[model samples]
Target: METLIKKNQAEKQLGLGILIVVIGSVFLLRNSGIDIPRWILSWHTIMLGAGLWIGYRRNFQGGGWLALTIIGAIFTLKHIVVFDFELSRITTALVLIALGLYVILKPKKVTTFKNYGQANQSDFKDLNS
Candidate 1:
């Protein structure tokens, strides 16, 4: 339990440090007369970094936030280079297909109920009596 607490604290510290570095670098770039786009400097980037950090901190127990981070980063790539929207569309389609295949190929669990008929008959007889 103590080790877990320490690990959580370490993660928090690491996240904060990363946040500071990102913010500092943006400011540094601005001070150096680099014309960063408004969108790149917006809250969206911050949120994406936060989501990625949180996902990592939690060891990716749930994939929702991590997925959002990935998608958001992919979209943001357009700002850095020429990313065609068609690429994102293709990625989405591929993800859907992978999910469908996983669902189809995954094993199903079958539950068995033993002596259920006997239990029901006894209960029915008791009620009738």
Candidate 2:
């Protein structure tokens, strides 16, 4: 219970830190007269930021966030530059390839017993009886 509480506190601190940095940068950039797009404050930006935070904090196995980041980035890029390619098809193919590679390359865990049934064949005999 204590460990859980501590972990929760640490996460809260991390969230607070991220919030402060994001807010500070936004205000600072605005004050400096930089052209900040209104979309920066949009729901997409929130999702993107959440993805980045989760990816960094949880080391990418956190799911949804990584996908969110990828999709958000693709959409953001499309806005900046027109592309004639089938983006969804390409993205799907790439994701499938990545999954295949992970399945093929990920390490297999091996389990071993220091002593099988305490080296007693009676362990099995008792089960049979």
Candidate 3:
């Protein structure tokens, strides 16, 4: 889980750097008639991506990434996207709720864990015995 956090941080930093470059390029080269800048989703996309990445990285067994993603969506992607309260918000809310319920109720698919710590096989056997 600690390694997962580090990976998330690395990905977030990389995403942020890419975002900065994208914004800079868009602004600096605006007069050149290139239209690719319209796709950047700012903080919403960045944070949302981070949440999703972290969640998947840590296997989403039990954590707060969904909450983070929702908050990110509200803060970052809210104004950026066209808000259709009836269609988009309600549907998304229901979907998220369902996903959360499923995550909570369903059994974990795999229970095995790979320990990469310094403890040797003898130490593990001793502990188990």
Candidate 4:
């Protein structure tokens, strides 16, 4: 009971953090005098997405966002880094291919439904009973 409560509380707090980030982002973006178009704005989209995902997870619902985060991080890094264009393109292609396969052909949920601090199962249990 206590464990469940703590888990729920932690999730709730994480959700609140995400919400704060989203709200803060909106305010900051509005205040910043930039030429970036609102329609293609990356920060707002990411902020809103993170907030929604975290809110859903607070209720024990899962989303395939962790995988998306990995893909997004790789793409963002590729965009920001000043590597050779050909090398960057190749790396980006490989990353997209791998991530696309994981998204489409995954055997099961990659992450176990538990706290990151908890121990992970090292062996699979066959349950045919």
Among these predicted structures, which one has the highest lDDT? 2
- Candidate 3: regions farther than 4 A off: 1-32, 36-41, 80-129
Better of 2 and 3 by lDDT: 2
- Kindly provide the TM-score of model 1 when superposed on the true structure, using C-alpha atoms: 0.53
Residue-level lDDT tens digits of model 4 in 14-77: 8779768866786687779654435334653564365447534644234455555555455444
lDDT of 4: 0.59
Please write out the lDDT profile of model 3 over residues 79-118, one tens digit for every residue: 4445444344454675577568867886667755678544
lDDT of 3 at 76: 53
Top candidate on TM-score is: 1
User: Cα RMSD (Å) per model?
Assistant: 6.3, 5.4, 9.1, 11.8
Candidate 2 lDDT, tens digit per residue, 1-129?
999999989997989898999878987898899977665766766676777777767756645766887666555443332255645445556656755875676556678887867767565676678
Model 4 regions more than 4 Å off? 40-100, 103-105, 108-129
TM-score of each: 0.53, 0.52, 0.41, 0.35
**How accurate locally, in lDDT, is each candidate?**
0.67, 0.69, 0.65, 0.59
TM-score of 4: 0.35
Clashing pairs in 4: none
Q: Which candidate do you rate higher for lDDT, 1 or 4?
A: 1
Span of ten consecutive residues with least summed lDDT in model 1: 77-86
RMSD of 3: 9.1
